[model samples]
Target chain A: MSKIGALIFGFNEYSLEIANNIGHKFGEIEIFSMSGAKEALEKEFAYPINRFDLSEDWGDLNERFDMEKSTAFCTLDDTAENIFLTISLRSSFKNLIIIAIAQNKESADKLSLAGANKVIPLVQTTSAMIADMLDKPVITEVLHNILYEKSSLKIAQIRVDKDDYFDGKYPTDIEWSREHGVIVLSVMHEDMSSEFIYSSKAKHHAIKNGDIFVVVGYERDIEEFEKLIGSRCDVSWSHWSR
Target chain B: MFKGWIVDIAYAINVSDSYIQTKRFFYNLLENDSYRFKKYFDMVMMALIFASVFIFIREVKYHVDDSLLFFNNIIISLIFLAEYLLRFWISSSITEVIIEQSEYDLMLSREFRLSKALRKIARQKLEYILSIRAIIDLLAILPFFHQFRLLRIFILFRVFKLFRYARSFQTFVSVLATKKFEFLTLSIFASIVIFVSSVLIYVMEANNPDSPVNTLYDAIYWSIVTISTVGYGDITPITYEGRMVAMIVIIAGIAVLAFTTSLAVSAFTEKLDEIKETKTVDDISKLKKFYIICGYEHISKEVAKQLVKNSNSLIVLDEDPKRVENAKSDGFVALNYDPGNIDSYKRLNIDLQRQVKAILCLRESDVENVYTTLTVRSIHKKIYILSLLMKEEHRNKLLYAGVNEIVYPKELVGMIAREFVGKPVAFEVIHALRSDYTNINIEEIIITPRMLRNAPLVADLHNARYRVILLGVYKKERKRFFFNPIDSTILEEGDYLVVIGNVLFIREFERSLYR
Candidate 1:
């Protein structure tokens, strides 16, 4: 139901990496750069590239991005240029969710004033995180370790019993209609193998006993979700938020 | 006085251009030290100094004529006086050049602080003359005070002028400076021992005729010779107490001598290392395809672990002297220069546009990382710029700055986590299929000229002798990825195929296809 998109504003290594990486999360991803320059860099990218004139009005872009269905990323490397892009995009569409990249705190403040919903600081994005993530039991296990550090979000692995109401339904369909705090990240099969929830293979897999669901939410939502699907481990870290 | 000087020098500067040229010429000789002719001026100054010292020594030894003495002392003094004043006149410009790019803010506020402008020139000249170098210059010409007979010995300070010419002595002097505390402690202890021992020995042996301890001078001289272990037989001890004192002095002297020697040796090694560290950039430029890793951090630790091996050359640029020293100790090429500045980048002379195949911007500050990436990108478009983005908001900005690869750990890990949950075995299979000197490997092989002759289609890969799966076809013209293209899909020259199979099998298939 989320019409999220990654709209990159430059044809660069940083932009291309983002497009390659964050592209899968978004249903719509559009890259804009200078015409011939975009075409020349086009050989290196798998994402679709569109020609954009920085000085022009965004009449065509406004028509393309539906407000309710779009989350646009304005990523020009220059601080002044990025602020101008945010201002231009925000002026064109008042309700659009515009996220931008900032080089420093000053630029972050300016981007926020220019109507960007979020500004990513460059310092915290070191390869050290990648080195940490590459260690074993990284995903769900590490999420628990981080939660102990006083994060508001909590992730718990729950076993889906055969007697549970979710047994006969598909994982994707169950998530679509369910109204709960829990967002299912992945599900582990009875065979002890995991699959991301809603993937082509995961969409058809039926819920069953001894099946594990890795869901993320606040403490209460996670607790309530735990009640519905029995958790193998003790539920704790609820007081971590304070 | 100004009007008289202009009229007196009219022959030398008949035109305005001539006046300007004369000023330019002196500015070069005195202040433009890096100029081709600055050294000749220094040589003349050095020769004048030696001549003055020689004349002074000659005057002391032989009674010279009154006029010749006047010429040697007064005329030479006059020449040095003019040289010293000329140097002082241009000294302010040297300070200005040293602080050139640093006065932008001061200039901006000049209108508000007009009162400070009144004495700025006079203040600069006064400050320069009071400095150590200026004082040294003044000392070299102080024979003008031949009026004060006591001050005439200060002319011997001309020997200090040699400190400027023989630069190697500067290193030795600095090494001595580093050992100053130890040397001071030794000197204090030795002085007290010598004084006390000489007084005691003189009292104990003054009545004995065999001892040369009659006067205080004889006793002092004997104590010094014994402490130095140079026991000149002309001053031997006769009394039992005197011999005991000599034994203690010789023991302390040997200990002090050993300590001094070791201290000097260690200091020399440290200075040698310091000298090598300063010239690291020169060493780096000789090696091609070396990576210039900017900044020192935990991330660089990981980078160093992997990159330090395999005959790969690396140079680190950091802003902290301590960090540079630490890197050197760990056997790394490092210099304390901020890579964000264009001047700093140019000094490296690494040919960033060509020879530097990759640059890693790993500074702790996101702003510095961004600025460094921008500078590097401007210098070289083809370089593979790898950077770590600390904030998600700056991703687009860094991407725009032309970073080839950005490691957003949280996002990338989150994505990987999401993928792992969906198809755990698939990623592992993909991982095992990585192509790098391995048997079972996956690689993206482009359509070679010979391979295009066969006009291979998507489904034709299964029929080949070697087992390789056609995972995807990378369309060159469209710049798109087609996962599992249909049998109807046609392949062309320059088209790349992402294949998964054994290394030897892939090679065999390639040979057969080309054949």
Candidate 2:
């Protein structure tokens, strides 16, 4: 298997947090600070820090890292700089997955347009959601465990390579959660647009090759389902060591 | 002895304690906005004002029965007379003046002269009589003296009494009052144009045999009618000079009309936001229980969406006008207000502890959220407050600021991003569930009395039959949640069942509970 590595840019709280949480998950990790070397030297980060400017050509980066398997993160505090970094990284390496952090909706749109694979808006929508259900401690704990703590539960996306099993089947025809012990959340079509499984568009559409199904379940159950369905999971089934 | 005497005299009556109590009651009903009885009193007074005005207007065009006229002229006016007297009585307390005079006499070590006390009391009553509101009230009762032909003109002032009963009318007046300078300038411009046009038309057209403007008064009327764009057509000019004057007056009229309209529109536009904010506050106060979200960012939008789905009322407040406008466009009751300002909460005018279910401080900064929580806490000590913690270190600070719940959005997002880097599918699932882009929902359904009355065990309900994963049950009495409760656990009232599944299936399961 090819090694999974992450290249995190910007030396800030969000970058450090992502680094600390996913330290042991990836095979290799590197940090690039956009600031001067003096400031980088002053800060003690768990990962070795390197200095990189947004304008620099990425010849060295391409040579040092396997661009296809590596993921780049643009976590700069400045919205314009982050978007510029995303555009630079995307233009240099088409296969390198790029993620970014945005302060608001406008910046999120700009970052996505700049070629970020995923844009995490620094919005309280996710956190403050549990406030209305504060009385339901169990739901809070379940969500807490899923987000912050490592549990046996895992979420994965599997691509349909062999269409024989599901080519003519509709999403609503099968009880994926009951039969396979996996909750099918959404289906990403060939056009890259995804819809919830229960959505009208997803429910009526016939399954085809190159379609991706996002599912959540235990690691063992996902691997079993992957083998039975003749599909390859994007995330490996290896146990999370954290 | 002096204090008892002062209390009696303060009410301007040497009656018993019940008299004082009755006066105090009437005072609350008449003037206290927060008093419950004031609403009913305002409603009655508003109805009377409308009725009296309608009757007076109807009498001009339609014949009213003699008895009805007598009832309206006497009975209604008598009611207004009683109201006027009560207002005059409550406007100033003679007892307070007497007490003040006695205190002053004692301070100076001099005798309390009866004439001095009488003069002070008379001055207080005179101030109330001279006040504009009091004068309107007096005019409202003038039709009672129907025999006095000159005083009958004051009967129309009954409409002015409506201003006191309808609060919105007062707001409108106050908003217009702010543009006093512009209106003054416009009125002055209009008057100069009217005066010149009226004199010119009178001089030019009055001598013409066929001109309708036979008198200076007719010319003045024509000038006013033309300038107002009404053009009554009853008055017209025949001579060429009069026609030229007419053209000039017409052009000047358009300018005056346009100027007045623009001035009014601009004035209202400036005050429109304030009026809307006040209306939103009023609407929130009417709600039995609603949430107050003190920020209109993305998170607040999401919260408001979910709250609307749950049938929970909420008002979104933000300091940024753009965000507030965005929230309004999104169909939420939103107001532009700084959450940290105590005046914002005071403007809501709701019994916070009773009417507000919770107050969410979702500002982008920890300091702002803390300040918001502090402001809310200062207003109501026990109202539930939830704050979004921007930094982990500020969690304790938020709690200290009287926040009942603290949520850290960045920390959650950071953890999710890490998971996404390692296991992309997991990230997708979690993201889909949290967002509205998917049909999946994690909902909490409270066990109804019927379900509890059935006395079914946890295993008997068959969550798998409904195809929903029951995560746990929150026991209300214990204030605890039992995760994946044992099959033998008996269902109880007030227990919230936390389940995750398709929204349709959740609804079906909830409906089945009643069966």
Candidate 3:
């Protein structure tokens, strides 16, 4: 039987849903609510659930959690209390993949401080949603479709390399949509908004050194774009590596 | 020869205390105290001799005993000639004056004398003072003609002496220097206005003889008075064409004045508002037992509702006064203040230590959260500071500032959304606590220092029939929490028992703890 992954002690409903959805993809799913963890455990015979209340004494929790056997323990609680619980449980279940939720940048730091393996922020997800919506559906849909197919749709932002073929050439002049098999959907201007989408009417829109191209392409195309345009991926993976 | 005589006189006038002391020493050694009197006598005798020469020259000019006048003039000239040569003989040589011990001492000690001692004083170069003395010397010895006596107007050159006393003139110079640009701009603008108005008025009023403005300068004068709004009415433009020009000038002048006034007023008003807001925030913060809401929004409204129900002491701080006023109108004790300012915290009596129990930082910006937490920590380190951070990156910064709790609205909302989608029952319980329709609410009770010493077990509270179930205990010392412990687990000091039921259960649980 595949090992069941359980997300416990989180205050958020969406986190539990996400964990359950992710868990259902692999094995049995269980959510041990922090508020009613004891009641849930007392009625364990009636329901297939595991309970762990963060409000309990740390000593009792440490002893009880040591006996549990699960693939991982994920927490969606955005409090220092939840993060401390996750860290304390990490020693007993060294192999348990610990995923935690952060309320904001501060809580994410606390989670990182508590030695969480993965800390996802709720704000960044929302910001990403806003960024996607503002950038338009067509480009987002294309990126989504590619990522959905289990292929990393690397949308890299590259500065126009002065040495490249399209260095000083305008977007219209290059005819990028037909040549590279990848669309240069938009360009991030210095003022922080997408530009080239609106520059289609202008006869000559010269590419500058600092102009970042938001190109949609496959892994190979991304690699080619990186090599040709001297661009890199925008996602900061420093936190994940740590 | 004249240049040498003038240099000697300057040397005498520019003498220092040290030089005088050395001169006294030489006089004492040479028994030359008589030389000082002798020098004065020689100058007087020289003046008398020059006077006689002047009288003789007048006699010769009138041809009255001209031969006798010539003889007298020659005798006086011979006497002055001897006197001038005698002065050179008595005066110190250039080399001796330059190499003198006292001169070298004075040069080393004084900045002014150092330049003089270096033979830097060139003759006739500083002729402003030299000319006055030389003229007096010349008047004493030279044969003066009556016809040339009218040339005394040359004495007016004495005004050049004012430049030597120029220190007092610095203030005037500085005023001119500073106002140079302003004066230039004003003059240029005035000239343009005058030129344009004059040309227009002249073209209009030139055909009409009845018009008072006869010349271009007169029209310019009228334009100045009219545009300045002075309306002296000394020169009126009677013609309709002239009046039309005047109307255009008046309108332009009014616009310029309005533009200038509005710019100044807006700038001053903005600064005044900022200062007033700062002071008001400081005044509000000074109140005891006041609650500080860091941000203004729906969450702030919820926080305010809970705070106002328990206590009337509450002050809401927001960058926007409209939002703060809106909160105030809603029966909240609100004050428009920026929590980032130290004065805002201090105004709410936050520094009183015991008065402020909690600080709620609910600003949308994580940067603001970090700043507020740091500021609050400076005044009261132990206060229950709850901050809302927009980003997870600021958690460590908030924690380092001694913040006890942090709330992320987006994360909480997302979690709530997920719960509503997946587990409807759990969601309902949370909804009741947060909903406006419900009276009952769930709040975390902090285990006080007093409660820990009593060592009350979970089962011992049965008399109260507190439906509250002991879910867990958080051990602060071990920095961990126990969840769903067995019934036999012993209750220890400093253990927080997480219980669930209702407000009544919470009250009973506390009551049982006392028992």
| Local distance difference test values of all predictions, in order | 0.65, 0.78, 0.54
What is the TM-score of candidate 2? 0.70
Note the residue pairs that clash in candidate 2: A155-B426, B10-B95
Candidates 2 and 3: which is better by DockQ? 2
Q: Candidate 3 has what TM-score?
A: 0.30
lDDT digits (tens) for residues B1-515 of candidate 1: 54334333442343458656866788888765344587787787678678777777888879877786686568877887787787776565432322332243247753222223325656778898898767877887786788888778877866677566544576678768888898898788888888988898898888898777799899899878877768787987788888887788788878767877887888778787666654565566657777778888766755654466435677888888888777777888888888787777777665676567578887756788899998887776778887877778898888988888776644553343233222233333333333133355545678876776675776655522354545456777886655446667888888877654556677877776777
Worst lDDT 10-window in candidate 3 chain A: A233-242
- lDDT (C-alpha) at residue B305 in model 2: 76
- Candidate number of the best TM-score: 2
Q: Relative to the unseen true structure, what is the Cα RMSD of model 3? A: 33.3
The candidate 1 chain B region of ten consecutive residues with least summed lDDT is B94-103
Ranking by DockQ: 2, 1, 3
Best by DockQ: 2
Interface RMSD of each: 13.4, 5.1, 22.2
Model 1's C-alpha root-mean-square deviation from the true structure amounts to 22.2
lDDT of 3 by residue, B1-515 (tens): 55345445656644667766755554442233223354455355545544554554465356656655554445554654554443333334443444453446656784234345444333323342245533444443443232454533322222222222232343344434445565566567766887899889988887788888788888888888887777887788888888888888787677556654554455446455555555554455446666567777655665566556554476777778898888878976566667778886555544546566567777677787788888777766577777776666677888887777666544544443333223222233333333335434333344565664554554453422454434345555675444434435556665555444456656877866665
